[model samples]
Target chain A: MTEKPMNAVSNEAVDSCGCGCGREDLPWSGRGTDLPITGCRFSLYPMTDDFVSIILGALDKTDTSHVWCQSDALSTVYRGKREYVVDAVAALFANAWREGVHMALEGQISRGCPGDVSGDSVLSCEGEAPNASIVAAATQPALAKLSLYPLGVENYIDDIAKVWYRAEELGLNPTSIHYATRVEGSIRDIFAYFNDVCALMERTVSHYVLHFTINVNSPTDEEE
Target chain B: MTEKPMNAVSNEAVDSCGCGCGREDLPWSGRGTDLPITGCRFSLYPMTDDFVSIILGALDKTDTSHVWCQSDALSTVYRGKREYVVDAVAALFANAWREGVHMALEGQISRGCPGDVSGDSVLSCEGEAPNASIVAAATQPALAKLSLYPLGVENYIDDIAKVWYRAEELGLNPTSIHYATRVEGSIRDIFAYFNDVCALMERTVSHYVLHFTINVNSPTDEEE
Candidate 1:
């Protein structure tokens, strides 16, 4: 696979420097999904002795044909259009879940990063999401911590505060902490909340990221 | 607690809007530890049926007197000076570790965020780190995925590339992915590598973040 220059928001050619230097003329607010590259790096941890099997089995069951995926010892990365990346990841988690085992997954999803244009080949694979059936099969309550970074925005805190407000309005129980907002609900609602926030931000911000850690099937604890 | 203005790198007071509005006079590279505020939000997950006991017991054993801590259902947050924040978190994780059970801790340690000035009260606490002994007592090899965000930098990829290069030089077996760089080593080494990278970035970027997930005592997986 050869590195190719993808069009910036202004349809300008970006430099191989991977810094959007040539695209400086385009206003940061002008960015959108017009740049089709999106990326997610995630690691799943199943708290059972059979973790290796659960992890590998989930990978085998999930269809990642639509995205470019690379798995290393520490984590797995999926890069492509936003929908395909999220679909593959959601299905991976659903397939990994076992009723009695506690599990957690940590990941970061980022879009419109200037450096991410190198792997644009995967965006060509276009069709409906392949893993919808698997994601529909799993429905579990999860506790999540989400931190949003609206990079390149001058008033980033405002963007975060707005998102937090919406999360509260949606009854996600968003409690503000130092670096993140805690939300508790079904996996579907949690994921939808994130998608909503990202959709809202896509109208303006160029480079944005959401970092989330989700835990499921925890042993009941009175202290928490 | 009432909110108060803190001095920015230029010694200018930040606006109450929490978006570095009044401090545009300062160059981003001019920022350093002179700001005297840091923040960390972390969660510990133990993969056992008796997780409640292990988690609560760890919190009870660890001391958070030197930093500001807030615990919610999803996670715990600590904010103060950089050393104190790290000390509290590292000690918390060390205290939480139990032999023969798989456990994971995820956290974000960030410095120089402009909106972080609201909690400066905790910075006045003085003295050496309170939990150094606890951190020294625990030494477990861990596998970690670390993602650094040098916010507000024009050439952010360059900053990340530099950190990845150093991780390789330190024999951390760094692997680059779409959104993060993975490193495998002891917990102490992983934390140290992050500290080293943050120190290097302190010279230039005013706002930066390091997000990490560490897993220990995993049931050996042959696939990995």
Candidate 2:
């Protein structure tokens, strides 16, 4: 079989951090002043009933601390430190599954570089953001996209739109039916997020015979 | 928002049924001689680790009655009556999730047409295949594609290759890194499968955090 490079296609839009942190100018060692970050862009599709409330309910239940979570009619995007975002996703899927909700999710997880950092005002964190020391010791940031589909839901457009409205109210321009976000941080953090997200999706959706996929890219400084 | 037709793109390969059943010649009403079928084509990606035996172990635990299931290194494929196939996937994912294995999956669920019926020996069923009357009352067949990514597992290529060998032994091409399949039957059967599969996946994989996606298509005779 042909071993194709996973990240051959670069379709996602990468915008500079709006905070004007000059995140890119920071040293690769992350020692002087720049703090490394982990981020992701994701979307979830509920395949069962099309009631908009289910999607909205799940989004509402999620904890956004350490992650900037936003949704549009098509999907939701989460960006922030890798650990908290992963935890948030785990909590979201667990609650949905316990409530017998069926849905599918798609996401891109990454670290080592800054992703779309616009709208940091809505960002919530348990404590102060990471410092240069945290970045210096962390692994190179990486990126990956994942998907999960719980079977049985249909006519989800209305519900998706409702969530989109909420995101719009939060000042996010969630206009695309196809949701995309950028993430940057240590490779370990990204992998951790990837692993945790996959685990949760599998546990919840697999029992229902749902199908899912994940493509990961961990770029090193040499590769960059 | 623009309401785009879901199945606007036709990239998947479609082949005629080899059973000489003349399924297409049958009336759209599915009344006298033809039994409508619901079918799905799917692939699973174990995102956590690369242990092939674990994935095979999960597949080994599945019940194929009412569906034809196959796998290669890259992914697994299931086809058959919607109800049976759905049941089988639910069982498979549930067992895997309980075992704490993480993986992702991709699938296509479709009705109104038969797909890749060339190999029928591998077909497994609890009772006889559907009769003409059963097909007659069944709704038009529908199809969809889905995905699930169980988090934490990694290095799955070796394990995938091991599965590929099994598919090759069964006479499947089983070479490409990408996996795709097809299913056919009534919409009810397909929906049943979808709901059950999602439920099972959710129940099994939720604790670990997984990601997934599913796209469905149910076509009426009029649309054709």
Candidate 3:
């Protein structure tokens, strides 16, 4: 069957700003700054008698990416250009499925909308970085939440404590089955830290299930 | 904190095979054969400008599974002892998430009950396979359906024709956005074929989203 390009159709009709800002005046719009920005936060639950071993094996096989990726006991978070984040996750699952493993996943994806202050910056690619002109055209963000029950590995919550300790170390209080935290930085800095955290978790745990909630608030947004 | 074994608590109260079969008579009940058997089926939509290439790259990286896995243009279906299926999936997502990719998924999970004849035979391992006496303890089946909407990759139906051709080849009719097929065999054999179909699809497409509906019927059931 012939496949149609998802973005071939204009996104303008549906790109209204959540904050009621007009599209024309939104940041990241003029000149070459209108590129899309997307982010996703997700968690994985590995199911096995030796789930720790399996998680370690999977982490060992993971390759670093340009997007921001973070892992705690509850979940992993990734933030970057929409396509980059999606590509990173797709590669991850494809690798795991090939290995006869099972897992459950839950996550959220977000993109810049007319009034989205959080997704204002364009993702950088080596020599080509976002300039002042591009940064000024940022838009609002569009987001969606999702959950995957591949192989029906719903028992991911079994390793919650692994992340709970991490959360505590990060000065965030955690509940029995959940934890929360906030990171602050420019989009690039946030992703860099995210990548570091994921690497650390990969090195620390053998098997794990994590749930992560990511909010790409403006770097200037007040901390709660 | 100490981690508690998830199954240390009694599942007997809730373990009635959906079909109404007595758990005691089931094959996997005695001799520590009572491992959890969770299963899930899912589809993914790669949201990228080069989605086809991204999907192709992702599928290339997929490995075979002990769990039964099948894919057509619309969705992928996986079935097996719950843990194996879940573990296989966990590995897949772990790999995908690491790549910073995005996709959407939808699927179902089912297990035997008193009335589910198709789910009766216990999934076996090695020399201690289920015998006639165990098969006699079959039951009904219970199932649940779910969907994942990461980054709104819900337009997975874009490649309906790939499945349409396969459906035609199998002499089964298909709809605009869906397809149907019935497999008649011992649960083990049925899952075996399911795995084969998924492997074929993985090889054929780079990026694909499939929607699948699977019905495992007794060999005695009449074909449509």
Per-residue CA lDDT of model 2 for A1-224, tens digit only, reads 12221112122323432111112331212111122343444444333333234445655665555565543222344555555655565444433332222233444443322212334323446663333233223353222222222222212233223332433443332221111111223334443434443343333321111122222221111111
**Clash count list over all predictions:** 0, 108, 89
lDDT of 1 by residue, B6-37 (tens): 11112122221222211222232212234656
Question: What TM-score would chain B receive for each of the candidates shown?
Answer: 0.77, 0.40, 0.34
Better of 1 and 2 by TM-score: 1
Docking quality tier of model 1: incorrect
DockQ leaderboard ranking: 1, 2, 3
* TM of each candidate vs. truth: 0.75, 0.29, 0.24
For residue A125, give model 1's deviation from the true position in Å.
3.7
Error of 2 at A116 (Å): 22
Off by over 4 Å in 3: A1-35, A113-122, A126-224, B1-224
- Badly placed stretches (over 4 Å) of model 1 are A1-35, A156-171, A219-224, B1-35, B98-101, B137-139, B155-173, B201-203, B218-224
In the range B53-168, model 3's lDDT, one tens digit per residue, is 43344444444335545443222444555445533443333223213233323333333211123332225533322232222222222011111111111122222233324434
* Top model number, TM-score: 1
How far residue A163's Cα lies from its native spot in candidate 1, in Å, is: 3.5
Greater-lDDT candidate between 1 and 2: 1
Ranking by TM-score: 1, 2, 3
lDDT of 1 by residue, A164-220 (tens): 677777778765445555677777667667667767667657867788888787554
lDDT of 3 at A87: 45
Q: By lDDT, rank the candidates, best first.
A: 1, 2, 3
